[model samples]
Target: MRRNIIPIGDVIAVNQMLERRGSALRVHMHDACGGQSFSLRADDGTSADEASRQAVGEFFSARGHAVEFSAGGGDFWAVRP
Candidate 1:
């Protein structure tokens, strides 16, 4: 499995956002983004759902970067932020 890391500061920021949002952030399967299939999974063996994906995407976008994934089983890459 391939791995990617979001900086500790970004992580903390996301956590703080989640903490502030509380359970309202929980996403249902039907809310997935276009029913996209993600080959990359976290260390916990879970893949990102739509809400989390959007959050991460926004985080990187704010830094002038974009996260990309292959259509099949492949690694994740980020553009310069």
Candidate 2:
């Protein structure tokens, strides 16, 4: 039951908005000592699912994550991953 509301500010950041709408994010957080993860993305505009991926990518970059949109066939388009 994850959601897009970070609650940091009334105005959600561009990256947050992008992540929310583009469906391009997932994460595994760790309060322990370490963490690991993976993600999948579609942004070719070839399918409805990829429609917002571009926005998500932009948002991720804005948020300060190193993003590779499609170097990998299933590049973790998800910003969080």
The best candidate in terms of lDDT = 1
Using Cα atoms with residue i matched to residue i, what is each candidate's TM-score against the true structure?
A: 0.43, 0.33
| Clash pairs for candidate 2 | 24-78, 25-78
In the order shown, the candidates' Cα RMSDs to the true structure are 10.2, 9.1
Query: What tens digits encode model 2's per-residue C-alpha lDDT throughout 30-72?
Result: 1223322223323433332354545545555555543444454
**lDDT for model 1:** 0.46
Give candidate 2's TM-score.
Answer: 0.33
In candidate 2, how many clashes are counted?
Answer: 2
TM-score of 1: 0.43
| lDDT to native, each model | 0.46, 0.38
Error of 1 at 15 (Å): 2.3
Q: Residues 1-81, candidate 1: write the lDDT tens digits.
A: 332334546545655665575423322111133322223334455555566666656765786546665554233355444
CA displacement after TM-score superposition, residue 53 of candidate 2 (Å): 2.2
Error of 2 at 32 (Å): 13
Q: Which candidate has the highest TM-score of all? A: 1
